[model samples]
Structure formats: C-alpha cells, structure tokens
Target: MIRHLVLFKLNEGVSRDEERVVAGVKAFQELDGVVPELTFWECAWNITDRPIAHDFAINSAVADRDALTRYLEHPAHQAAAARWREFATWVIADYEF
Candidate 1:
C-alpha cells in the first residue's frame, strides 16, 4: 500500500472563510467517493495555531504506486488542486507501507 500525504498553507492575505477557499475545501472534501483509486481518504483543516503547522491536510492511501499515480492524475483531483493554486501552496509525500 502507499500512503499519500499533502499539507497546504494558504497564501498570505487569504482567509479560510473566503468564497474561493471555501469552495476549494468543499471540492477536496468531496473527493472520497468520486475517486476510485482511493483506498482511504481523510482531509481537514488544521486545529492548531502553531507557526509550523499547515492550514490543511490530506491523508490518503492507495493500493500501490500505480494507484497513487492515477489518484494524482485524476481529473477531479487536478481540478481541485487548480482551485487551490489560486490561494494556497502545498507539499506532498508518498511512501510505501
């Protein structure tokens, strides 16, 4: 199995309550049932105010590297990411379990 993690930090001056950010969050939250390659999916906002913390996170799993690739390349995933591109930057990590 592969664990795919992503952490997102909103761009300076962007707020979570903004229309675009709200829409972006909803888009990602709706991906669980929309993407077939996802064996597991969890996404949510960060709870802490620590300086080192990211504003949002995605913790998901797939059957394998190929599955991970498909999940990453899926059109729905791409579109959701594109929306975030307008207000946030993110980092990702993938590894075998």
Candidate 2:
C-alpha cells in the first residue's frame, strides 16, 4: 500500500476559521467517497500551536503507486487542491507499507 501524507501551512493572513478554508478542508475530508483509488482517508486541523507545526494534515492510503496516481488525478481531488492552493502551501510524503 502507499501511504500519502501531507502537511499544510496556511498563507499569511489566512485563518482556518475562514469560511473558504473550512470549505476547502471539507472538500478534502470528503475525498474518500469521491476517489475510488483511495482506500483510506483522514484529514484534520492541527490542534498544536508549535511554530514547526502545520495548520492541517491529510493521511491517506491507496493500493499502489498507480492507485496513488489516480487519486492525484481525480477531478474532485484536483478541485479541492486548487481551492487550498489559494490559501495554503503544503508538503507531502508517500511511503510504502
């Protein structure tokens, strides 16, 4: 399986409480049902206030690299990512399990 993990940092002046950010997070949270390739999905706001911590995170799993690619290419995922791109930057890591 491929575990796809991401950490998101909100841009300056952006807050997780903002309606747009909330909706963006919801969009990502809903991806488990939208993308067939995704076998697992978990997304949430970060509760920690440490300077090194990000504002949000996504932890997902897929069967393989091909499934991961499909998940990435899925339209719903693309739309959610575009919305987040406006207010946040992210880093990701994929690992096999």
Candidate 3:
C-alpha cells in the first residue's frame, strides 16, 4: 500500500473557527466514503501547541501508485483540496509500505 500524508498550516490570521475552514474540514472528513480509491482515511486538527506542529493533518492509504493517482484525481478530493486552498497551505508525502 501507499501511505499518503498531508500536513497543513493555516494562513496567518486564519482561524479554525472561520466558516470556510469549518466547511473545508467537513468536506475532507466526508471524503473517506466518497472516494472509492481510498483504502483508509483519517484527518484532524492538530492538538499540539508547539510552534513546529502543523495546524491540520491527513493520514491515508491506497492500494498502490495507480490507486493513489485515482484518489488524487478524484473529483471529491479535488474539491475538498480547493476549499482548503482558500485558508491554508500544505505539504504532502507518499511512500510505499
């Protein structure tokens, strides 16, 4: 399987309670069942207070590179990601396990 991880940092002055941010989180939270290529999906807000910690994260897996590609290209995933773009920036990493 391929593990796909994403870490997000909210834009300066952006609050998690903002309407758009809440909607973005809700959108991602619903992706697991909506994206057929996802073998696993988990996402949440960061609980740590450390400066180095990201504000949000997504931990997910797929069967292989092809499945990972399908997940990335899926319309629901694309739409959720687009919503996050309005309030945050993120980094991603993928590795086979």
Candidate 4:
C-alpha cells in the first residue's frame, strides 16, 4: 500500500480570510475524480515560533501513488492548484508500509 501526505502554507502576504479558506476547502472536497480514500484538515494551532516546523496544515491523504498522480493531473484539481499556487507553499510525500 502507498500513503500520500501533503501539507500547505498560505503565502506570507496573502492570508486567506476564514470564509474563503473554508470555501476553498469545500471546493476541494467536491472534486469528482482521482480520489478514492481521502481526508483533509485545516490548521487552527499557533506555531509561529518554531524552526524545522510544518504543521500538517491543509492536508490530504491519498490512498495510493496512482491516486496522488491522478489527483495532481485531474482538470478540476489543476484549476484549484492554479488558484492555490498564487498563495500557497506545499509539500508532498509518499510512503510504503
């Protein structure tokens, strides 16, 4: 099995207001394909003073590597990604167990 995890940070000068962020989050949930088993989260913790730190802020767990690749290549995901690119930093990792 494969495990795909991701994290995101909104841009320094472009913090999304709570409402917009929530909307975006929901929009992501509504994506129609390339996701089989998935989960997401939004950050609510204060972690501004730590180094080597990345809270699992804005995360998704894809069920497998194929899903991860398909998710990235999906048209709907591409649209959302274009929007996110302007105001986000992201990390993705894949693991096997």
What is the TM-score of each predicted model, taking all chains together? 0.98, 0.97, 0.98, 0.59
Superior candidate under lDDT, 1 versus 2: 1
- Candidate 2 residue lDDT tens string, 25-83: 98998897889998889999899999999999999999999999999999999999999
Off by over 4 Å in 2: none
Candidate 1 pairs with clashing backbones:
none
Regarding lDDT, does 2 or 3 come out ahead?
3
- What is the C-alpha lDDT profile of model 4 across 16-96, one tens digit per residue? 565655555555656633444444323342356565555324445565667667767877777766766666677877776
Score each candidate by Cα lDDT: 0.97, 0.94, 0.96, 0.57
Give the per-residue lDDT of model 1 (tens digit) for 1-97. 9999999999999999999999999999999999999999999999999999999999999999889889999999999999999999999999999
Cα TM-score of candidate 1: 0.98
Worst 10 residues of 4 by lDDT: 37-46
Instruction: Give stretches of model 1 more than 4 Å off.
Output: none
Cα deviation of 49, candidate 1, in Å: 0.2
Rate residue 23 of model 2 by lDDT: 92
RMSD of 4: 4.1
